[model samples]
Target chain A: MPSSPSNQSYHHGSLRAALLSHAMELLDTKGIEGVSIRAVARLAGVAHSAPANHFPNKRSLMSALAARIFNQLENEVLAQMETTSGQRAERVMAFAEAVVAFALTYPHRYRLLWRRESLIDHDAELHSAMEAVYALLIGTIEGEDDEFTTSLETRAIAIWSMVHGYLIMRLDGNLMEKTDELTQAPRHRAIITALLEGIGGGPSGARRDC
Target chain B: MPSSPSNQSYHHGSLRAALLSHAMELLDTKGIEGVSIRAVARLAGVAHSAPANHFPNKRSLMSALAARIFNQLENEVLAQMETTSGQRAERVMAFAEAVVAFALTYPHRYRLLWRRESLIDHDAELHSAMEAVYALLIGTIEGEDDEFTTSLETRAIAIWSMVHGYLIMRLDGNLMEKTDELTQAPRHRAIITALLEGIGGGPSGARRDC
Candidate 1:
């Protein structure tokens, strides 16, 4: 019987995955500065040259990690969208909630995903994955209306900015102490719904002028 | 005649400010990691132990830097607010424009301002300076109406999140390429106005239901 990939011993095929996993662990504990080719190889219990064979350099290794993060984000958000059943606003909120949860749980990974230095080369695969997520958001917003007053791209950017900003602030504990209520999912849903409603795109029953 | 503090040479009284200025330069060029007590001292041409006298440790130095940044932000935003003349929405857009411009010009400093690790201690002065900025935002939002339906704090957070999110995305080049127009002040003003109007607060002529 063939051994499962997880159960298989380290080899060229599994070596890449093993190094990435170890790098992720290092990132969680020591942040971006802690991640190095040598450190990852050491953690993976591989020879010093093994990571180089797969990644070639520190930048390549970081790029791969960022790509993996984008892929994971896409999968997680898609899964949330799939299970979410409600009005367009509710579904979008659910998707956004999933994103916020992921960011808060893995703030380092999320930070690395957006770091300009790491993304200097404009990795095509990462760009595509991010675009897919944006498409998901745009589709969800447009799905709510037969006609949206704002351009699809504008709405997407605005909504993305709002949610992303909130998540970052929350993770950094920048929110006011009195806003502890916002930490709860129900309260969060209400805030997001209100924000969407304010924009005339949510379940608030208000229609924006086309 | 007593020498002015600004004219004072590097001595016990001025050593702290000198080290901080040098550290800011390092932060601008090399990011937070490049900032070290030794490097700052070397740049300032001060004794190696001078920074230790003022900061006691690296965290304290960073905390002081964060506080200084908050103070600068408050001053810049306030200056923009003072010079801006128009309706409530126009004034708010002006304030947001100042923030975005500042972030873009000094992306590294702006980034350091939000980093949680650099701000672990919950420094009282930093907290106060941040609150002052928030108060400025809230005042601008509330100034627009004697009878606003939304609570002041909620409106402030939503708007702050929107603008802050937009700035971060802009700096990271995360916004869609087609929206390059947003890099301009006029385009930014329009979008912020629309977002505020969406929330029933700006001059977009689209009042949301309270």
Candidate 2:
């Protein structure tokens, strides 16, 4: 076999993305504990020193990985929220769907993002990046005051906690095993509806229901 | 120092407690990854084979640890809930306090129990034991409702998810940073109040001042 390329052979422009891509792949196969800068460099077909140029340490690499994950999440949820204007029920459902969909497809990433708070002190920029994601959700629920109740902060926290909580429970399989009758979609819809109705008023006061 | 009696020569009850107590101490100091049967036995002044009789493998030992942790949590929460009679706000506040207290004081055990879902299929008894702890919370919440607006199944999933999510967020140090001004006490009260009022339309609605 031919000898592998040395540290000098690595291209600079794409090394960061390549490292993150390989790191996520390792996380998929071996969980978070398996991810390391050296391990990622090995998988990315680069020399060990190549990864060092992009990430000084594993923590820095992880912060970037987490930021990208949140960036993707923000885009997905923002897109879903765009589809449901003026309809409170639809808005809540879309927001909840965005959360559950992300959790189901990328359970590891979901867990990692939730754990970001533990690292806020370790990295200041990450706190703002994550806050941006939270702000997007809060904005979606902070729609203009109707003739009825109006408190954006309360509504935002209420909706966020409810949806976030449900996603965690479902991903952990707690909700799945505890309730046999309802699958994820229908249960999600019911929860979304109940929370909106409970917030704005019962069915009659809700902005949209179907 | 006096010569310590070896676990092999120790009485059965004392050895079992010794193993568990030593393991718990390790858990507090070093986290789950640091605690193992061998380490626990060593810390307990036992021979290598001493713990095998009490816990065949790591999984069983973890299960026993989780069960004992939840048993303590259940008793503490139930006692607090009992002290608060018919006042919904007081009852809810006590419940939230009990949860935060457990998580803050026993951060390791709280993480162990919440993260235990990852190991559900490892043992049947462990799974059922977790459900029973959840059932205690559901039963208490159901007791508060004069008439059910949401099904018991829905309520259980929703309530457990809210508290679990909150505890996870707090223990991971996420919510703590956000609520430094209010302290976790008021922030959790706000979340719990939103859940209660968000479920039913009444004077119980969360105060707009928040």
Candidate 3:
């Protein structure tokens, strides 16, 4: 029978993990274009049809990998929040720092997470995995708004957009590091503190065409 | 003579413009990958070797296109700043609004500007054109630090990073619009105001493990 000892292949669960591991390796080396079902199956040392058992198509495989990587990001955020000791703002900043670190470490994986067109993004597991990190951010900004009357969602968006934007700029090489002028902390940290305290300023003299 | 009317074809300057126009159309329809020396020349109705006179290769062509596009974005920003009336912060926000608008209108063109690897980014025209936008931002924030002690560069970076990040996230479908809980303003505007005013908040309880 196909179920016999030698015929069983690696356990069903582990095979899927193996496929994902191989897929991730390909993504790291070759970027999104390099990842495909047949390639992943080959990397895993299985028949090309074998991966179809877990992921019927390339999109499904990408979505699963995205879900796994997103979960890893969520775990990184959680771990940072857990160990960081400070005001909620500090923890929030830590969350951002953790993201920047993770992104810098795995630039390709991070980039793929945002290429929604390539993934079955609506897949339940992938959706929840992304929402988990987003929800954590919203939860942090929930009731702490003491100075500005901005909506909680707006506040969260502001922080996240800055964090995401800065990282992507760095990754794309559109932005580069300059020593922090306001504080001796990392440029990113200073920027985060600015996000917290606000970078209040305006023209001192007559407001002419800026 | 080689300079005769029939042999002259299109004038050199006009031909450059025409080729760029065709390349832009290709880029809009098919993205960065669809663009190449051979493809652009075909679209321009010139001989396949025609584009090489202006652009030595695809990289040079892409760089020229990026410079041209960046200059257009700069014009948009300047136009907004010229028309808007209010505090300098309002003018600054208008600058960001213009960028977001331009990006949404020609998402492909805007994306291409940041793909430095595919471009000769150090080319003088492209470098100066990109720096012009950055300089405008820094100049706006120059004397306006009436409140926060953050450096001018940091403040500019904060605003720019958020704008860039928010637009990209929106483009990639990582984030979407939700009604602003704080104001009737558009979600992006509300977030911009939050950036200006600071999203001041803290946990309502004692500082424990978050």
Which candidate leads in TM-score?
1
Q: Positional deviation of B199 in candidate 3, in angstroms?
A: 1.4
Cα deviation of A14, candidate 1, in Å? 2.8
In model 1, state the lDDT of residue B189.
55
lDDT (Cα, 0-100) at B197 in candidate 1:
43
TM-score per candidate: 0.82, 0.81, 0.80
Candidate 2: misplaced stretches above 4 Å? Answer: A1-13, A34-38, A46-53, A116-120, A146-151, A199-210, B1-16, B36-38, B46-57, B87-93, B117-122, B143-149, B199-209
Chain B, per-candidate TM-score: 0.80, 0.80, 0.81
| All candidates in order of TM-score, best leading | 1, 2, 3
Over 4 Å off in model 1, which ranges?
A1-13, A29-34, A47-50, A118-121, A143-149, A181-183, A199-210, B1-13, B47-49, B143-150, B181-185, B199-210
Query: Which one wins on lDDT?
Result: 3
In candidate 3, what are the lDDT values of residues B1-210, reduced to their tens digit?
A: 333323444654466777888899998998777787788878766788978888888889999999999999999998888887677678778888899899888988887886655788468888889889988777666664344545567778898988887787676656463342333325677677777666554322232210
Model 1 C-alpha lDDT per residue in residues B108-189, reported as the tens digit of each score: 7888787766664577877787888888887776644333333446557777887888777877777645476544444455
What level of docking quality does candidate 3 show? acceptable
| Candidate 2: docking tier | acceptable
DockQ category of candidate 1: acceptable
Clashes within 3 Å, all models in order: 1, 0, 4
Q: Kindly give the stretch of ten consecutive residues in candidate 1 chain A with the minimal lDDT sum.
A: A201-210
